[model samples]
Target: MHPDGFAADLARKPDVLGRLADTLRAGNPWAPVVPPGIGRVVLIGMGSSAYAGGVAAARMRAQGLVATSELASSPLLPAWGPDTLVVATSATGGSVETLDALRRLPAGLTTVALTNTADSAVTESCGAVVELAAERENGGVACRSYQHTLALLIALELHLAGQDITSLVASIEMAAEASAHLLDTETTWRPQAADLLLGPSGMHLAAPAHRFCSAQQGALMVREGPRRSAVGCETGDWSHVDVYLTKTTDYRLLVFAGSPWEAQMEEWTTLRGSTVVGVGGTVPGAQFEVRYPGDDADDVRLLAEVLVPELIAARAWQEQF
Candidate 1:
């Protein structure tokens, strides 16, 4: 992937997201294809696509819907049936595993494809298609597509619940504004955030369970773009799994902030003197905190916060050459 192109892809996020917001405001894209009486929902994708699906599935489950996200490559996928709805997500519409998974599904089952390419192979396999509208990523990275995937999945969630899209549209607009703010002010925060979190041992990211995709996608940006070592864990799970690293390594943690468990994480990081970078909100003992226009909203954080590491990753990747 071209680092400069990846950076350019990120620079256009606000515009792309804003256009998506306008598209939603104009029409509900999933209404016609999403059938009624769907008792169960199965979402499948790989990498960042799966990461977005996981959070969307969790949100759907919390609403009392039986929803699950699985790796497209999993051999043990749920049985396909008439009452089940399958959502196959692939930003480029070209994941081999996802295409193979679709091929194995029984005919006459309701399946929807979420992809940026209009007439791709994945779209041909599914009965209905919802274009991500993220445009092509010339960088060959999935930065904007990842963000658009989460936003569209949320839209799908709202549709499945029979909820109004007014609020969601507004939230998308707010997230676009937040993203623009972050990109406009990156010079002030990017350097410090990169310096604080780019330790010899790599980076660690944590976020609340609902917004965990931010952490996952952020870590992926670092590792995928710059070939760095970065791991993402749930904020609460950090105390159990990642806390040990703070004691032994040159640990640098990037907390997405807003988790109720933030205090618990802060208690340990403060004690270990680990470098901490907080995004979207405050962490008591953080070495640096990155905040933006709509930082207070969780939905906004879901759509916008990943830009922090994406920008840092872009900078680091560009520097490597």
Candidate 2:
């Protein structure tokens, strides 16, 4: 992986997130593209875009909107008519699967593309467009675009629900601040990376939404920088498959501090002599802790939390170079 390109992508997060906060404050950025009379919402995309859709689907479901997520590659679309809304996200607006999914939808169905580029393939296919105002990532990892897409999806959901996002904007600004601070102190993570990089790394989060977004990004960034195997799963699910691998292999775990299952996983892995590194708050008996400055580990906090793994990846690149 190119070290300078990796760092450049990580550096763009603060500005990108800050811009999103500003856009939220200026009223709904996605208002023009908000689908009319959406009964069921299906979000589809690939990679980080798919994970971002999963995050949005969770929040939309919580708001009593019938929402679900599917990978654009294999969208097991249920039978639904024109009222069904399909929102596809592709950072570059050029993902073939996403465009294909959009095309395969019922002709009368309302489809929107949440993408970084307008007039791209996805935009040409969808009925409406919500463009993300983000710079192109120099690195292959979709760092800033993932964060920007998350903010836009959250904004879109709030607009569709006809709810004010004042509190959400505040949380976002706080998250941006946390991201800036993390970038400043990114070097502090090097030793931790050195200690943890001796083996394969896995990331597990407590909640499904956070797990989907953070863990997927973690694995992607890890592969981009360290060129190592990084697996992502929910906390409880880890015990079923990943735990067995950890016990027998030289595996390290990156447990996002949230859930009771996290503590159990830490203990289980520690007992097996696997190094566990905590991402957010302290995990009991973690080999190292990367404390992020937020009480709530909501989707907004993810803007800040993603920085840690990128730093680890950067360290790996540095070590190799």
Q: Which ten residues in a row have the lowest lDDT in candidate 2?
A: 200-209
**Winning model by TM-score:** 1
Error of 1 at 258 (Å): 0.8
Regions of model 2 farther than 4 Å from truth: 197-210, 295-297
TM per prediction:
0.98, 0.92
Q: CA lDDT of each candidate? A: 0.92, 0.75
**Residues 1-321, model 1: lDDT tens digits:** 899999999999989998998899987898989888888899999999999999999999988888999999999999847899999999989999999999988777799999998889999999999999999898999989999999888888888888978988888899889988999999999999999999899999999999998899999999999999999999999999999988899999999989999999989999999899999888878888999988999898999999999999999999999
lDDT of candidate 1 vs native?
Answer: 0.92
Which pairs of residues collide in model 1?
Answer: none
